[model samples]
Target: MSFIKKRTSHNYDIYESRGHIIGRITLLTGLIFTFLPPLFLWLVYGIMPPSKELINGIISISSVMLPVSIVEILAFSPMLGTNAMYMSYLTGNIANIKLPSAAIALEVAEVKPSTEEGDIIATIAIGGSVIASEIVILIGMLLIVPLSTKLNNPVIQPVFQQILPALFGSIGAYYILKEWKLAIAPLSVAILLNLVGDLPTAVTIPLCILSSILTARLLYKKKLIKVTD
Candidate 1:
């Protein structure tokens, strides 16, 4: 009845346990720091926020974000591996930076995600990515005024604007093609949802993930997609 899987490779289990223990500690530390500013204000300055307002704000934000956060944790952890999860979450910006970096590293290493080798690669990738991103941010901040001015130029604006879409599209396209059958249901449903109107992204994301999982299951059952033992 252990949450961590019992692996034949004791080293793997040990590594996973260590990672989870550290990750949880880091997560808790982060949560405490996140509320530190408000707590400091209340204690030191007596600038206490209204409890009713705080409750309402928490409810409003959590209603949209909490479920998405849960889904993200479940969906990304296996693919990212435990150490990578700790690194990526600690640094923030997973989808836009850490995920793509880890994916590329795994692809380059020819390692399957969720495997021991993948865990190492993911940890390295995320760690390296976090370092590189921080360096880039530091450099960008130093030249912020000049960089912002240049980036805002009409000629340069479109490139900056499309960067996220382009990056995700290129990386995502490869996986989508690799598992086209699995992609079809989710893609179609997502498109339909978009056409219906502006659905909250939190709702859209989990729905798409659920649809993709269901489609994959059905396809496997129908023998359209193979499930290897």
Candidate 2:
């Protein structure tokens, strides 16, 4: 038993070490590619925004996105594990697509998050989802010109708007059903906040996460929830 445990730990450590090295290389490559289009325009066309305007543009976008990015990293890292996090960020759509796919994969595989097995499963699931989404996007792009009018119809527009909410709601429902006690605090907070006013996701998500963590801790201390290995 000791030998098996040690071997598993060793393997996991190796996986994490390699994952980090690969992740960094891939992310750096992606970053370079991301700047390529702007670089091309500047070099070939000599077309560039004024320095002041560029700075302001960057600041405006960053002000909104930086907080959300930080919050997402904190909230998602544990569930996604290191490798999956790298891939999800690179692919984009972490919240709407990668996250749900990874979560559902974990649930289906009966693996707990933050474990070696869970990390491996999540990475695979995310990769698959990325491929699937790309294929769908390709198809959509091809069809969009032809279908633009139909897609923009008011009835269809409403359905498109609801798609993300429906996806999240379904996943949330499953988890809440499984752990209703743990859901109480966070769910209530989310609902109350929605009723009170429109809060940015960066604010509401972190608060809900904090509330859930505290509630879980309290429940565990009171012997209201069981921890199983």
Candidate 3:
């Protein structure tokens, strides 16, 4: 859908932002990085040949990325106007602040309030999707392992593990433009996390959370930041 919003002030707040242009640029770049994950699997495995699967599948998948990149470039793009409208309809009232489509879609579609009938159905649906996805991936592994199993093939794996630096540079460039300090904290924690993943998430989550909070507390205690004081 065209993202050209109407000219009303209310609509402007719904659809416009100061960094709309830059947001589109970085998001498109981010989306390109996001596309690399699945696209790598498709190319490495030759998952779908055009002759059998037809062109529609290509179009369908591309739409998801288009929205990720250009926000409202696709029908389900995270347009604030659309978000406001959906929120107004779904929750029975328009909110003062705009929410992204991702949040509203989750609210309206996935997260149902618990009722007397049961809360188990939602959990079952999530588990069911997980199982179904695993089955599909297992089938792909079976088909592709034999077809493209050359151990020493040139394209088998990247010679230099370049994706890491490239991703970090791209994301770092974007964040450094705005919030370099906020960016550093996550990068610091992620580096620390790489060595600690052997721990269960149940353990790791609390550890990381507690560590970050304690670190923040210590920083605040030194009178470095006034909010905590």
Clashes of each: 0, 0, 0
Q: State the lDDT of candidate 3 residue by residue for 1-229, as single tens digits.
A: 2444334444545444533554466556766887797688788987655654667777766755444433222222222232233322232212111222223333445443232111223233333444555687789888776766574477856843676677557645653564343345545766677776664444444444455556656666886544410
Where is the poorest 10-residue window by lDDT in model 3? 92-101
> Model 3: how far is 94 from its true place, Å?
34
Against the unseen true structure, what C-alpha lDDT does each candidate score? 0.87, 0.91, 0.45
In model 1, the worst 10-residue window by lDDT is 1-10
Ranking 1 against 3 by lDDT, winner: 1
Ranking by lDDT: 2, 1, 3
Model 2 poorest 10 in a row by lDDT: 199-208
Identify the superior model by lDDT, candidate 1 or candidate 2: 2
Q: Candidate 1 on 74-121: residue-level lDDT in tens? A: 889888998999888888999878998898898899898888989999
Instruction: Give model 3's TM-score versus the native structure.
Output: 0.27
- Measured against the true structure, the TM-scores of the candidates, in listed sequence, are 0.83, 0.87, 0.27
Q: Which stretches of candidate 1 lie over 4 Å from their true place?
A: 1-8, 41-53, 152-160, 227-229
Q: What's the TM for model 1? A: 0.83
